[model samples]
Target: MSINLQKGQKIDLTKGSGGLSRIMVGLGWDEAQPAPQQSSGGFFGLFKSHSQQQIQDIDCDASAILLNANGKLYGREANDCCVYFGNLTHKSGAIRHQGDNLTGAGEGDDEQIMVDLNRVPADVAKIVFVVNIYDANVRGQHFGMIQNAFIRLVNLENNAEICKFNLSENYYGMTGMVVGEIYRYNREWKFNAIGQPVKEASRLQLLLNMYA
Candidate 1:
């Protein structure tokens, strides 16, 4: 019973049921197919047409930013609070990011992040999941060249999908996206579908500054 969430929708992850101890956050995306370039061959009849050569894989990197009770990062200097490709797991061991081209998870998920809700620290209030294109500026790439981008939450115990958020809007100039957030609410964990795009950012660090 998976629910397709709309942007800005919020849902309870652990409620009524005893509590969800483990869950997986899966993200997926594909490079938009370039238009078929069927140029009419002139006198020489030489034509170069279509796909692979034009659209290279857009390296979309996803990261989780851990925020404290006040919804703020530890500090601008405390970089260890963030878990990304460089830092696969947090010191608390509550969150583990399976990043770095680990697309074998299937179901079109390019990357996945596992969370032990029960192990999260008390002071930590939220885990913001963000995705950005690596070296987008240098590569001249943006979300506009991306397609089928989505984020989903799965209950590991039964392999049931809790909810999914699809970023189906036009992101012509966006280089980054704020996919979603998992935060504590009255001692319970909840998920917020924040499918918002960020402009002019070519790296994940810039998106983090939103909280700092």
Candidate 2:
């Protein structure tokens, strides 16, 4: 089925076919800043002043996506500011290996986590993806804006768009979190946007609750 997403909306994938035992988790964002550098010192300031140096923006576009597939959780750096895929084991969580390209230029950045339905463990029920903004606070500087970020599930068997979550905007430079579930009855994957604009602390708590 085609997945429809609204700004700041959540979708759950666990209700889907029990067939989806494994899946991938992906994360991506846009970088809207230019490179930064230090400025020359004045005659009165013999040494370069730390205050005069420009701090680089925290680019969330280049962060590693974290997930819990089976009993074990896994993480891997994104290839670009786009799509990535990982193998999910029900017990271990996710086994991420290769990354994909979902830059979202004109087409949009589309990152994904692939799950093999047959490999899921009985105790494991869902998958979570936490979108992290790389270097959020550096030299007391904050990352500016993060918009139009999201996560989705692609059915490897039929090549269908099963579930999705949309994170259209975040004002506080906080991270984004989305959760997906693999249902045992219908054999279909379900997804939901759990928290919009969630901070690092909240995200960590959620992950701990789910995995721990």
Best by lDDT: 1
lDDT on C-alpha atoms for all candidate structures: 0.82, 0.42
For residues 82-185, write the lDDT of model 2, one tens digit per residue.
12233222233333434434332333444444555455444334444554444343322222344455566666666666656655544454543433333333
How well is each residue in 1-212 modelled by candidate 1, as lDDT tens digits? 99999999999999875668899999898876565445643211222333224434568888889998887885344445688898898887988998687322334788889999998888889999999888888867788887889999999998899999999999987899999999989999999999989996787779877887
Lowest-sum lDDT 10-residue window in model 1: 42-51
Clashes of each: 0, 48
Give TM per candidate: 0.88, 0.54
Q: Where in model 1 is the C-alpha error above 4 Å? A: 38-52, 75-79, 102-107
